[model samples]
Target: MNWKGHITLGIIMGLPFISAPEQIFLLVAGALYPDLDHDVKSEIVQRGLYISGGLILVSILAYLFRPEYFNVGFFIAAILSSLIYVIPYYAEHRGITHTFFSLGVMSIILGYLTFKLSIISPIMASLIALIMVTNNNLLGKSIAISVFAWVLYSMISTSFTTFQGLKFYIIPIAIGYLSHIVGDCITPMGCKALYPSNYTFRKKEGFFGVAIWALLVFYVVKLV
Candidate 1:
């Protein structure tokens, strides 16, 4: 399925856990982000960059107007912008990043950035970044990811242990990302969700999309 279908499924699977605007944004963004390696031309990726840019603008506004959240605003923008750009560049379609290990690593990195970095903004930024991975038209994704990979080499290596004070808000990112990988199982070349397992769910590829959409509608009703 495309980003539209994937994003819908992701949001549906995620709505039960969301009550805040930040989570909502991140959840939808996460749904569209995993496809950065598959289809860089997808509209969701561009939309995500717009969203990220908007957040950065918001951060700047906060820096000038809402002094209380200024540091956090910029921090959130910076962290998210970095992550969104990095994932797609290093990862190929259905490559290592599509695996459970990569997902776990991404989640851990997100958790550390959220807590160890000071609580709220890092997670939000990570969510934003994930969405923006699709934004290859601008190539900001490439440059940003390269710089981030080099700069955060040491920190990323030690990130798994940094989740000291994480909360429930981050669950959406994990769930949405998982939803993306699973949804892609409806393709001829199945995703590398388990990496070394070398599995493909071609049998379910044709009609599974309908099932996902059904679930999405069901979840949307409940959320409403």
Candidate 2:
């Protein structure tokens, strides 16, 4: 899937947890984080440095100024989340970043954040996870434009209200991350989600992809 499709899948997967719509950005971050290990020439690495840099600076300021309330764990974990997911310079495209080990580490970090902090810190942390430069599934500015449109549409049209905020946030972070791997599974280049094993299988993209999208649309309708 392209970034637009991955992000749309992330939103639909995370739709159940969304209430105030700020969470959608966080979900988008999680959805795209799995592709964090890109070559130095990718768009995210070149253009997204500001995002990750700003996040690091913001996290530091929050930690220094609001030590009583700031979630230092989340900040640290967020940086670590990005660092841990990247493959070494010699690895393949969907290398360690797409592995189950990476997912488990991320889940643990996000899970700990959920246990310790308010939802806002986790949102920042999600953005940090998206700091890497990857080469696959990128779209043009159209991707960002489409993401904005979809979120706006959901916010305007959906009736699902807020619930347990922390639980909702954490659950969807996991789902968004997994949803990326699932989306990549259908591609000709399948993901190494299981890790330590060359045992991933590719799904036929034609009918399989259509069915997944159809199910997502149906689920979105149900959410409405």
Candidate 3:
């Protein structure tokens, strides 16, 4: 899915835990995370990577040197800009990277790291990030079922851990990530719904071709 879709999904799904301002940050990061790997041949890849790296660096710097003036708006803009370019360059018409398994793996890894660092509530941030990555090509019912199953398993298995909020985190992350899948469905390069099941969907024309310019405009306006 695109950055707007990512942001919208994050805001919608993250409402349960974080405030509106934080939602914007989480959504933006989610939208840009997939573009960490970029190639020079692809303009989106080059630009997106630049933007994503810049945002991450800026956020880190702000957190370290000027916590009081950390501009969430700037962070959000960087994220949206990066995703706008990256989707077409790297992720569009992709495979598991746009699937539940990929999203789950990313969530687990990031969640663990966040937990270790005690950064921004690991369960909440991880869930938001996972949700942002999830695509919607998989049946909504199937996604829901999967999320529920994971939640149950987490609650049961991690009941004794301090990260007991894993269950609560799973639902939103699943939903948010699934939202990306759903958003991609509207574009030409559809997502692979039954990833491990070998089901694939493709759109003749994806959203990135024309939408990138618009996304840049919107992001600039938002920044202003």
Candidate 4:
């Protein structure tokens, strides 16, 4: 599946749990992140690196201004997150990044970064996530713009304290990442989510994909 499908699946899967602006952004980021292993020619890969690079710089600046707040742990976390984006440079397309191992690891890193950043600097985190969502080109722009506008409204009205805990952010990352793997699994090429095992998790696109979407939508409706 393509980025659009991956993001749509992520949103649908996460619909019931989304109660805040950052959750939506996290879901989008998680869905798009697996594609980071794509070639340098892929726009998602380049833009993801750009976002990670910018995040590293932002963390450094924040530390320089207030070591007491940003601290060494925060600085190290930023570097670790930035390194994730760089993995694509040396990784093969649909390689390690598509695996469950990467999914779990990325969820922890990104979840921590977003959680800490939102707690200490909501606006900065919001803006960075906004960029991460909106950089996926035209389709992404439309989805991100609408959701980001909602986030901005929430920020103005509620001071953007909507997300409060680590688990809240991590849930979206895990679900979104899993949804991306599922989406790719339905494609003819299948997915090597197990990795290191040459086994491919393949499925028929039409029936299986529709069933997955239908089940997810039904669950979302049940929540509503």
Among all candidates shown, the one with the greatest TM-score: 4
- Model 2 error, position 11 (Å): 1.9
Model 2: residues with Cα > 4 Å off, grouped in runs: 40-91, 110-165, 204-224
> In model 3, which runs have C-alpha deviations exceeding 4 angstroms?
16-24, 35-93, 119-164, 167-173, 201-224
What TM-score does structure 2 among the candidates reach? 0.58
Two-way lDDT contest, 1 vs 4, winner: 4
Q: Local error of candidate 1 at 175, Å?
A: 0.5
67-110: candidate 2 lDDT, tens digit per residue: 77677665775565334333333346677756657666665555
Could you give candidate 3's per-residue lDDT for residues 101-183 as a string of tens digits?
Answer: 75565444433333332356654654444333333431233334434434544443432111134433333343345446556
In terms of lDDT, the best-performing candidate is 4
TM-score of each: 0.53, 0.58, 0.41, 0.70
- Clashing residue pairs, candidate 2? 38-133, 38-134
Clash-forming residue pairs, model 3: 131-176, 131-177, 134-177, 135-181, 136-181, 136-182, 188-203, 190-203
- lDDT of candidates 1 onward, in order: 0.55, 0.58, 0.46, 0.67
Between the candidate structures 3 and 4, which one is better when assessed by lDDT? 4
Query: What 10-residue stretch in candidate 1 is worst by lDDT?
Result: 156-165
Give lDDT for model 4.
Answer: 0.67
Residue 168 of candidate 2: its Cα lDDT? 53
lDDT of 1: 0.55
Which runs of model 4 end up more than 4 angstroms from their true locations?
A: 40-70, 121-127, 130-164, 204-224
Superior candidate under TM-score, 1 versus 3? 1
Per-residue lDDT of 118 in model 3: 31
Cα TM-score of candidate 3: 0.41
